[model samples]
Target: MARDADATKVRILAAATDEFAAHGFAGGRVERIAARAQSNVRMIYAYYGGKSGLFDATVAEALRRMAENVPPRPQDLAGWAGDVFDHHQRYPEVLRLSMWAQLERPEAGAEPREIYEDKALAVATVAARPLSPIDVLVFIYAIAQAWQLSPGGLTGLEEDPAGGDGVAARRQSVVVAVERMVHAQP
Candidate 1:
């Protein structure tokens, strides 16, 4: 029974992830999620309370998966940046989901202070100097996501075809930028 319950929850969460990623919290439909998951609306409410609850859970799960899959490596910040960029490129829905959450439920997505504190501590442990880890992290993340968020603004790939190497060039630019940031003197 516990196994069945867990399986049901996984299915529901998977379905919810797709729905929320595609339609966001405001546009996502509980009925569509239920049908996709082969579960009923009551089960969704019982498991997740409501659409907001489900969205929160979905976002939380996505974050957890990201952390597990591509943890930060202060020793190799450039590699880590590339990995993060690759992950974002492959799973763009994660970014979309985050953007949707921020746009639709600004107040709800505020991560707990402890999460930030823990990350800061982790960064401090591996970082070379006393530079703020958060700053480094944010810069690397922004560089990695910039192309995806607004390719035309950064690389002009959207307007002109720089051949098939444009994406590779953009990715290399992110890696080089991260390398510079990591090596730069504070």
Candidate 2:
């Protein structure tokens, strides 16, 4: 069989995403990730250099996928908020990995500032009112990702927090909150 380096790399990143999402950088195990990817630890280190490099690659892949699936809707920031909520809900691993990065790599810093700068600039150019551009983008993101950060991942308002009407209601709440913030006069 022809060796497929790209496919191996993809599998490694996918495995790392799930591992880090569930257990975070500190608790995530390289052996588990290797088993999940069907790739040896040596290959992982060769491709990513070390556990830290693997974690960075995993985070970058998650964010890249998110950006592709949920392109910014700066003009309709309210709708954008709803999209973010939906995106995170569908691919929760992305959100979990991000939280893990924040907790584990506080000094990573900027988080690829160009992406954020573009997003904030898009919002700022379109909506030049209320809060600053960066504020609007991040607040919407926080509202979208808040459920993941909630203790026990339950906001106390839902009996079955991750399903049915509860999720819909929470999503609506996120959209509404962002709408209010986007519309609030300075």
Prediction 1 global C-alpha lDDT: 0.80
Q: Against the true structure, candidate 2 has what lDDT?
A: 0.84
Q: Return the top candidate by TM-score.
A: 2
Candidate 2 worst ten-residue window by lDDT: 106-115
Task: Give per-residue lDDT, candidate 1, residue 172.
Answer: 89
Regions of model 2 farther than 4 Å from truth? none
Candidate 1 lDDT, tens digit per residue, 1-186? Answer: 244778888999999889999999999999999999988899999999988898888887877777667777878888888888888977887788888888998799623345455656767787476467788777878998888788555556355535556667778889999888878886
Error of 1 at 99 (Å): 0.9
lDDT scores in order: 0.80, 0.84
Backbone clashes in model 1, listed as residue pairs: none
Candidates' TM-scores?
Answer: 0.87, 0.92
Off by over 4 Å in 1: 1-3, 110-116, 127-130, 151-164
Q: List, residue by residue over 22-84, the lDDT tens digit for candidate 2.
A: 999999998999999999999999999989989988888888778778878877888888898
